[model samples]
Target: MEHSMFCYQCEQAMGGKGCTKYGVCGKSPEISNLQDLIIYQLKGIACYAKPLLEKGEHIDKEIVKFVENALFTTLTNVNFDLDFHLEMLKESQQVKETLRNKAPHGNYPEAATYNLSATKEEMIRDAVIAGVMYEVDLDPDIRSLRSTVLYGLKGISAYGHQARYIGHHSDQVDQFYFIALEAINNNNLTLEELIQMAMRAGDMSVEVMSVLDEANTTRYENPSPQKVNVNIKKGPFIIVSGHDLRDLELLLQQTEGKGINIYTHGEMLPAHGYPGLRKYKHLIGNFGSAWQNQQQEFDGIPGCILMTTNCLMKPRDTYKDRLYVTNVVGWDGIKKIELKEDNTKDFTEIIDKAIELGGFEKNEKEKEILVGFGHHETLSHADTIIKAVKDGKIRHFFVIGGCDGAKPGRNYFTEFAEKVPDDCVILTLACGKYRFNKLEFGTVAGLPRLLDIGQCNDAYSAVRIATALADAFETDVNSLPLTIVLSWYEQKAVADLLALLSLGIKGMYLGPTLPAFISPNVLQYLVDTFDIKPISTADDDLRNSLQQAN
Candidate 1:
């Protein structure tokens, strides 16, 4: 078979092979090549930057921001314009060149030495050779480890971006980004060494998530239990999507008293929990479930759409014109909202559009969606949860969270959630919860049975909650009655999964399908070491989990 590009860093790679013609997330071959070139240049930048970081020399903060944005640009469905990626690649190349010149004495790899061409034709030519799989190691195991580290880096970069976005920056996290990218190119590293490095990436990710958690809570407020209204109101409204609370906050501030309501969508559902955000009465409620359901949920919506991050599908023409993208998210024809000098975006345009659209005449139905069951909120009820567990009222706990996708197999999560015994508590976050968030799970011990922690970045909260539970029980996390059933669609999920594994949390069930990046050898290593299982039938897996817990 012939192929134009090779990209397997997502769940829906073609036939478990690399994306040959185009990415399942609508990335074309040109964009794929540009993504590869961008990463290649990032590695170059790291090769030079790592040495400076190691020597305690101060690197520019802008470089760190660039690294974050460049990495985030490659996330699934985030950026699709060929010209835009080329510009990023060009900017990455210039930054890489400047860094390389600073450390001319540094023994940089071929990536650093390769000169980027100014013309588009020559750039594409260079990209073809810069692909991650260009020089495949003879050993599949070695290649697998390399891909694992690269994917993990992508996840790390994403969380790092979010952290930096909210006025939080970690030198350690920035240094690791450089070191990890530099190591990915080192040819002498053994398979064991590579595997260890991968775990370290996971370890760093846990730290990044923590930093992000603090950044979020400090910037906004600690998430608490709040019931989000899922139904839209009668007035003109704007639906803000993605996981960017900063953007949502700005939108809320700008739209206040403008007679336009603000509604959260997808991972933004947890925004209702932050007191700083929910204070505005016009910041009404959540409008939809996850990103995957946007097409149907957003169809005929009488408001504008703003994408602050990933999980944007090809906007259906029905709502495409009203869709506005900000930060790292971009589609060729979409209107882009840029931040002002003070780092706060003026959402005047979005607010104006919302008023012009003049949303639903009346809410079609009255419905409430409960979210914001994050760590503090849920742990506040820890005594009750523990008593329920001990008294046999709650039989088990399931941490079912990760990225959601559009594949049919994803129905497994919905079915699993529906069939989970009433005695079990379902802890979920990220977009994956959309599969079951709407379904009524009732209550357990006076608490909602399903807990929506926060975004994928809030995996740190889940870790904290689990560790606290284990400590309370005088046992380790694995010894507690908990199972992690994760649904993955993209690299952020990879980082979170690796973080879980790095924490020694074991026996996870990963679905709807395994990452296409995991080679058979790596898959075997994960199974043998962590007992990670690819999910089977929901019924079978539930039975097995319950039996194991007992």
Candidate 2:
């Protein structure tokens, strides 16, 4: 049984085809297969937890940990180590055993047959068997849609795990995770029911985002406008990527005055805006554009790249020795900074390595990019923004943003932004802005029209600005003359879409390519309810989106 190692966890996965022999991110077929089984078993645990939540039973912290850790394990560039997966399996089994003992007669339809410690070979055989032997299989569309929701929830769980590591917790979020996970695994579900479940997942993500927003803002203070430097400074430095602010904060603290410069990369760019983080003079500006550009951007860089979360592609040989994995992001042979049981990561080794690298000898001239237009920052300017819209100076508001990928179609985002009418205002964030941030789209009413609203997690800023505009005009958000042209390459984008839908902001144009995990029925449900359409040509899509506003 020669198995393929192709995977669909991230948009950059081997031309969007499943990896068969070894994952493009260095994940072997055995590990990939085990991950799939972990997902299957996680779904089983979620199903078991759902009835308990519904029955008003207090969901234990251990079950919540299982849900969060399982989702984190499945993220791109995370958990490539087979031993890590085995450890997770053992832990999951222990949790299940405890749960089974606690509720001997509980409703665990899926759990009845789940074996947490199954070998990779056995797991792959079971996946094949389930497809061939299951009497009642979900419709392909439903499975796709459910998978979409599951993957999106996985993104949420990753963020939630990061927040929890910093001592944040939300019972509502934990309960919803169990509910959404259960919904994905249920065979008794109808298309309509699944659609409803998907919407609910979106609605719940708002709560999740809110919790995370609170966690970030309360700990770091509201992000304010900041100019980030792209030039790497002289002396040893570590480039921190992914979206874990807590980890970034700790790295900054450990490296402070230690003769090492710290730089943000990928989603970490937004860290510069937080008062707590921005105070670190050594925390330099962003290193590269989105996650996909790492191969080129990271090449020959004289430092280590500390990845706190997903969006990691396969490491190139040039810088492979310098990459460090933390939190859930893992790669074989890479030095992983293990977190204590309480989620605190010790960065003493990472710091020592940074010093050993002896980064660039000369200070690089400052290369700056503007960012930090998050909700709190934007809403602070609500009066001015509302007045500008009323004055007809800001004719159109176009939210052209999301995660970035290496796919050829993604260039459409850059072209679309470049082609936006001179009178229109473009608000962007995340790695997707790499597409058009270089273009000089002048300001409107003294404010730069091309606004970078932080990272994908800062989609909350877009939501807040839209709602504030609506409230100011005393109208619904959809009725406002604003357009959302989104480009997605990962699960964070999926979670952001759910947030938009939960708020009833419809007529979104989403693209790059439709998620391979989304089923036809689920797509139809989204198309019907949210008017979500795939991206077309830049000119055509922009014209159509603006026309709808008209």
lDDT of each: 0.85, 0.79
The local lDDT score (0 to 100) that residue 398 gets in candidate 1 is 91
TM per prediction: 0.97, 0.94
Global Cα lDDT for candidate 1: 0.85
Q: After best superposition, candidate 1 residue 437: deviation in angstroms? A: 1.0
Indicate which candidate wins on lDDT.
Answer: 1
What ranges in model 1 sit over 4 Å off?
A: 1-3, 104-106
Worst 10 residues of 1 by lDDT: 100-109
State, as a TM-score between 0 and 1, how close model 1 is to the true structure: 0.97
Each model's total of backbone clashes: 0, 11
The residue-level lDDT of candidate 2 at 349 comes to 86
Model 2 TM-score relative to the real fold: 0.94
Residues 1-550, candidate 1, lDDT per residue (tens digit)?
2338889998888887778888888888878888888888888888898787878888788888898889889877789877778888878888987787777495568987887888877777788777867886557788778778888888888888878888887888787888888888787888899999989988988999999888888987888878777876798888888888888888888877788888888888888998888889988888877787788987867889999888788788899879999998988898899988899887778778888888889776768778777788888998998899889899899988889888789889999999999988999989898888888889987888898898998889999999999989999999999988999988888889889889988899999888777879899999999999999999999999999987
Would you list the clashing residue pairs of candidate 1? Answer: none
